[model samples]
Target: MSRNVILYIAMSMDGYIARKNGDVDWLEGDGSEPDADIGYDEFYGSIDTVIMGRKTYDQILTFGEYPYKGTRGYVYTSEKRDNNEDVEFTDENVEDLIGKLKKEDGKDIWLIGGAGVIDEFIKKNLIDEYFISVIPCVLGGGIALFKDNNPEIKLKLLKTEAVNGIAMLHYAKR
Candidate 1:
């Protein structure tokens, strides 16, 4: 089977992925009892490769340790950066990169995003699936999950589930 490029991410009810400052502290959700398994572990297990934007990677660095330690990671950027033991920084065209990745024998690829990267992937129709967790909050304004005037791409909802007040929506390109 061809490897799938999955856009797995969380967004606020109003459709913002993060605050204007790129802070996701709101994801904790009213300091209630810790969130239950929203199937993150299961989803993480299905992807061996991760693709993210430089801004997302930089934001992750502020958290100290790299969360995706063992997974093969590719940070998409226009700047020149040396590859580390954890990730390879590249400016390769999204379509060409994804085409090569899909041919490799491995688990699905995770399109971890920060808006710009997601937009590029969407433009090229490279993402095969979307796993979105809708958190319960509205940030009036911030970085949006979907930009205005994007190309219309229809999708089919495959599943929906609620866990700890968070709604998880799974979709496949139609």
Candidate 2:
């Protein structure tokens, strides 16, 4: 059996997932630097599949000319989308999605997100762990990942890494 349902996201210090208008240049360091965070690379390599909301998938599409390698990624959405080798779009709710995923023989299932998707999984008690990268900057106003958290949640710290003024906090649900 495979371990399941992990969420991976990089958030600004003030808890915003992106800037007010959805810009993230600040987290990228200077204009010409490459995102060479080894920890994140290693983590992504471990996952066999990726699942994300339609908006997040679209946002990823807007960046980079090449394809996302290794894993097959699924976009969670109700509307039909053009099928591609890299992406599979589905509108199934999280529970149904997870149930269907559990039947597939795979390694870690990654929830690449919009805050709403992550919040929905957490609220449904379906998320297994949270791998959060805390970028060292604050966005006064923007999209937040925990905006609808109704219950206080606790995390068991698994490890920490400091790179590019970012704190990679690995927390498992307690």
Candidate 3:
């Protein structure tokens, strides 16, 4: 089976993934349903690998416990540092790495966030699908989901749903 790269992330209504200071505290909702994960569990189950940028990896580390313990995780970074046994750090060319992964035998890959990594993958047209959850708030200034120099790409809406004030959008490359 061919592997695919899916960009699954959440961003504010104004397109910011996090505040200017890299704070994502605004992702939290106010007194919302306890099970506000939307379709995260299902989406997580569909992927066998997760790739994210250094900053995103650092943020996940602050969560106390590793959230992606069961999956193969990779952090794209050039800095030399120690990481969890379950995670691998690489400064390899993103396109080449992703191409190799896509040819290997495994489930789809999940492209986790932090604008730099996402922008790199987007520039190469490596993402096959997008599962974006648009939160109900707007951040006036911050890192955007798509950076300023991104190439224009079109997507076909596969599905869309609203739950607990979040709009979940699923799209496929057109």
Candidate 4:
């Protein structure tokens, strides 16, 4: 099967993935239900590899335990760091690296993010699909979804669903 690169992420209605300080407290749901994953398990199960930005990796470290242990994880970073047996850090060109990965056998690649990595992939036209969950609240000011001066890229809406106040918008490159 052809490998697909998917951008699966959640953001506020105002289009900010997290607060200006990289805080994602707004992403947590109120205790209306004790164990609501909102299709996360299904999405995670479908992807075999994950690529994320360095800042995103740092934030994940603060989450107590590493989350993508089961998946082939790569962190895009220019600086050298201690080798992680579970995750690989690379400074290689994004376009070249992703092109090589796509040709290999895999279920799908998950483009987990911070704005910089998302913008780079979009610029290189590497992303195949996007699954954005627009949370109900809006952040007045923070990191925008696509960075400033991004190239024009069109998308075809594949599907949409409203799950517990969150608008899950799925789209494919057009």
Best by TM-score: 1
- In model 1, the runs with Cα more than 4 Å from the true position are 30-35
In angstroms, how far off is 51's CA in candidate 4? 0.5
The per-model lDDT (C-alpha) reads 0.91, 0.77, 0.88, 0.88
User: Can you write out model 1's per-residue Cα lDDT over 1-174, one digit (the tens) per residue?
Assistant: 789999999999999999999999888544343556678889999999999999999999999999999999999989999999899999999999998998899999999998999998888888899999898898899999998767888999999987777888999999
Clashing pairs in 4: none
Clashing pairs in 2: 77-91
Assess every candidate by TM-score.
Answer: 0.95, 0.86, 0.94, 0.94
Candidate 4, residue 96: CA error in Å? 0.9
Q: Rank all candidate structures by their TM-score, best first, as comma-separated numbers.
A: 1, 3, 4, 2
For candidate 1, the lDDT comes to 0.91
lDDT of 3 by residue, 56-134 (tens): 9989889888888989989999899776777889888998898789888999999998799999999999999999989
Give the clashing pairs for model 3: none
Q: Best to worst by lDDT, what's the order?
A: 1, 3, 4, 2
* Candidate 2, 54-160: lDDT as tens digits: 87777787897525666877788778788788888877777987888889888888888887777788888887788888877777888887866556667788888
TM-score winner between candidates 1 and 2: 1
Q: Give the TM-score of candidate 4.
A: 0.94
